[model samples]
Target chain A: MTPSTDAPHSCTRSEDELWASLGSPPDAHELQCLTCQEQRRRLAPLAQAAQEWKTGTDPEESLLEGILGRVMHGIRTEIRRGTLFTLTVTPLGPLRISSYLLLEAIRDAVDSIEHVELRTHKIIPHADDAGPISLAVSLAMQAGQDGTEVAEETRRTIAARFAERIGMPIGTINVTVEDVFQ
Target chain B: MSGPEKPDQQQLGNLVARAQSGDPRAFEKILTYHQRGLLRFCTSMLVVPGDAEDVLQEVYLTAWRQLSTLHAPEALGTWLYRIARHRCIDHLRKRTPQPRDLQGPESLAGDIAASDDRSGENPESNAETNAAMTDLRRFVHELPANQRECWVLKEIHDLSYADISAIVSEPIATVRGRISRARTTLAERMRPWK
Candidate 1:
């Protein structure tokens, strides 16, 4: 018997429908139709190959280590060129710090708190030289922990750390519990 | 080869949020989790291992730089795949169009065979497996780029039609049509294997 082409021949169901039927159990019409059954049998190998390809382990898994190294190196270099923010005005020049540094400090402060994990934090510095900075932090609290208490504690910790690091008052610290983790 | 176990949705969300906040470790974690799948996708799209690696690197770097732009944390996997697809297209466009260079059936087949760990299997069985895989890859490579993209996204990557539509920036109907067309082509071409 000749192999079926992609076009529908005399059968009412198109070849595409036959191919799709291979994915599921045959319906009543499909069970009764010789054309559909033959087409499906021919299409079975391709379907099986696709399934194997999806579930099989990647051949290039070994290259991931090298790729990761290269990618992380690129990211770190970019991180080093961090955005510079003016911390305060000095006698001769403005005291500036990299946003990377500020973020790291905030991360450390958040990490020091128990039962609370920092998801994201944004520091909005005031436009003027010596105005209060606004801090927004999203956190994930440990399951069964008090979210309100954790948020309050996280806010106080970040506030104290920010005051010590920059000697500036914090304006409205927003601490939102974005997730709960075990 | 078996892929790594993916993190749960909540864990993935947490990682994305942390990465957005300039956490290098979190970003690296996210990248590592997705590396194998993305690399396979790039390899299929580019057909050149070196070029695939370059595009994969660009995908990660772009994702990291634009991490803030990704508002939906749960969509990171699809988002990364989209970046990869774009990068692969750009890379292919920049190449000096050589039809011969586009075909790399042996490359993927060799990689799979080399990495095959069925040590206890008989040599004849292994060879048959390799031959079948080579044929499969060749038939897939013979597909038109658009059909190949849709087919690979649907079959190999196991993406839904909607997700494939989002990645390819086409309508769901279009994506479905392309995949169906691809299936028909492959079904006809791979009849001997059946």
Candidate 2:
């Protein structure tokens, strides 16, 4: 007796095609094919192994912690080498602050505000070698806070902090609500 | 088991912007979030834990220095993966070509055993699972480097085909094909366990 061409045991799809098909909906040819079914059964363990590998915790968490510390140290040193801006002109010379310091000040100012978290900030110094600067900050507010009122308060708080802490006048303060957190 | 949840794109973008503007804390947050997946990719590609650790450190440092070069802040995840891929390739090139003595079979087995205990499986079943996992890791390690990288990025890291393509600098079709070839090889090799 000859085997029927459509028989489940007689399907001839390549293993590559079968594996690819597993990623998508089973085609009609795959629906009734014993060869495909067997292949899928054989492949199930491999898929499970891959999933386990993905979700497994690193065996050497201590090593990763060490690496993180070193990486952050390198980053902090590199940040200190970044561009500097003039905070004010003192009698000695220009009282310049590194970009890192400026960012820390802005972070501290925003941290003091209730319901407003600073996400990012850009400090734009006057191009003509002046003292006044523009500040652009993106903030995330606590859920249920009034956005307009919070934004206005943030702008005023940042300006005041810059004037009081850094002794520099802020020309314009732009506050954007980029996210809301519960 | 599932990995930690990734920050949404907007939050990640904000983190990237903050890092670019010299915020160490923000950059540290980004590093803490991605370090595990990046380390896994590097380990799979290099097949050695020490080399993977070194590559991961370089990847994060390079990312920090070049943060300003990344214009699309939302693409930070793929961008870091791309950096890791390049660094892994360079590390691989610097070393003499030879069969790597892959580490972690015993440790991985231990991990599996612990997981099995949590799931209330017997020691007999735990041993079988451990053996199967060890075999699968060896099979994955033996694949060609390109196929291994693409396969690890897609399967282990859960990256999309497009994201894998961008990291490996291959077209999406090529990424899919590489991943397909990898799956075929792994399935065939693990058929005995079934």
Candidate 3:
């Protein structure tokens, strides 16, 4: 009897393998098999639809602009609320004052001093209740202005403003005369 | 599947770094880069465009707050998709239970028509194609969430199986299975058109 010469009638690969192969061309077996070819044909529209869905449509410009507005508003709100450490008052409830506002107040006070320019202000929160809040303020004094006098006057003005406006007492104000500009 | 290509890795990394360090402009860049894809992802999962936009709003807000928790800057796309998916699912869960048809094709078609009109597209010219798309949209919306998401991330977005797996929090094998099943169901439904 002649040896059996016919190839196997069915694809050896599982359905999962066939589906995974969808990204690439079908192999020889799949090309020859009517069943796999039919399946591939059915899957073609889906791939085409996917391509069409992506290329044919775009997000509404209004939607994009709206999202940008919302995100920016959110970030601003976050910054306004995020930089402060709440100070708990004994009799009153919690008082929330942002470090940014505090810096602005300090700048206003320093700017009022004659021939003194406010460079920057930083709040150094006390590690413990043993010390009150401290501020480091940098000022550029005019060439003829007395450095010591301007520093002292700016320090007192900021402290008084913090007490008057912020209802918070300051332990110390460190004035750094950064430069003497003409 | 080849979905939308991500922004270049190093560029995205720099954006993420700047955003993490409290640069709002950098963060806005990130949001703008991902917004459209995330919006489409949300719309595919939710019925209302407004609701989808709402979810995206929340997603970006939460991302801003929790950006520091993110370990990988390059993975922002997947992270954003995951957030959008969770928010969309939550939005769905909170809606009062109603018959699915209450939010069906008629409304979606109306949305399509209105959107087309606004965009100056001649819906009359593409009536047949629009009708077919409406039917396909309805069929897709009817699918279970897992299958629908799998299909969206896979075919529609052209994301790889591994990327879909990460976004959906499923094994690669599971992702492939969901996509295959979804394709089969959609193919069966689309046969009439064919």
Which one is best on lDDT?
1
TM-score winner between 1 and 2, please give it. Answer: 1
Candidate 2: stretches off by over 4 Å: A1-32, A87-95, A115-119, A126-133, A138-151, A168-182, B1-3, B98-124
TM-score per candidate for chain A alone: 0.68, 0.68, 0.54
Candidate 3 chain A least-lDDT 10 residues: A1-10
Per-residue lDDT of A1-182 in model 3, one digit per residue for the tens? Answer: 11111222255444455556777888888888886776666555445455557666644535767777977887777776757744555557656677656765786687578887665467788787434688887766778988889988998899888878887877789988876665
Best by TM-score: 1
Per-residue alpha-carbon lDDT of model 3 for B44-78, expressed as tens digits?
89866577778888888888888888889878888
- Put down candidate 1 lDDT per residue, B154-188, tens digits, no spaces: 88887888898988899988887788777777776
DockQ of 1: 0.50
Of 1 and 3, the candidate ahead on lDDT is: 1
The alpha-carbon lDDT assigned to residue A27 of candidate 1 equals 92
RMSD of 2: 6.6
Specify the CAPRI tier of model 1: medium
Clashes of each: 2, 0, 2
Worst 10 residues of 1 chain A by lDDT: A1-10
> Of the pair 1 and 2, which is ahead by DockQ?
1
What C-alpha lDDT, on a 0 to 100 scale, does residue A149 get in candidate 2?
94
lDDT of 2 by residue, A1-107 (tens): 21221222356676656655665767887778777777777677777677667776657555777998988988788778888888778899888878777778898
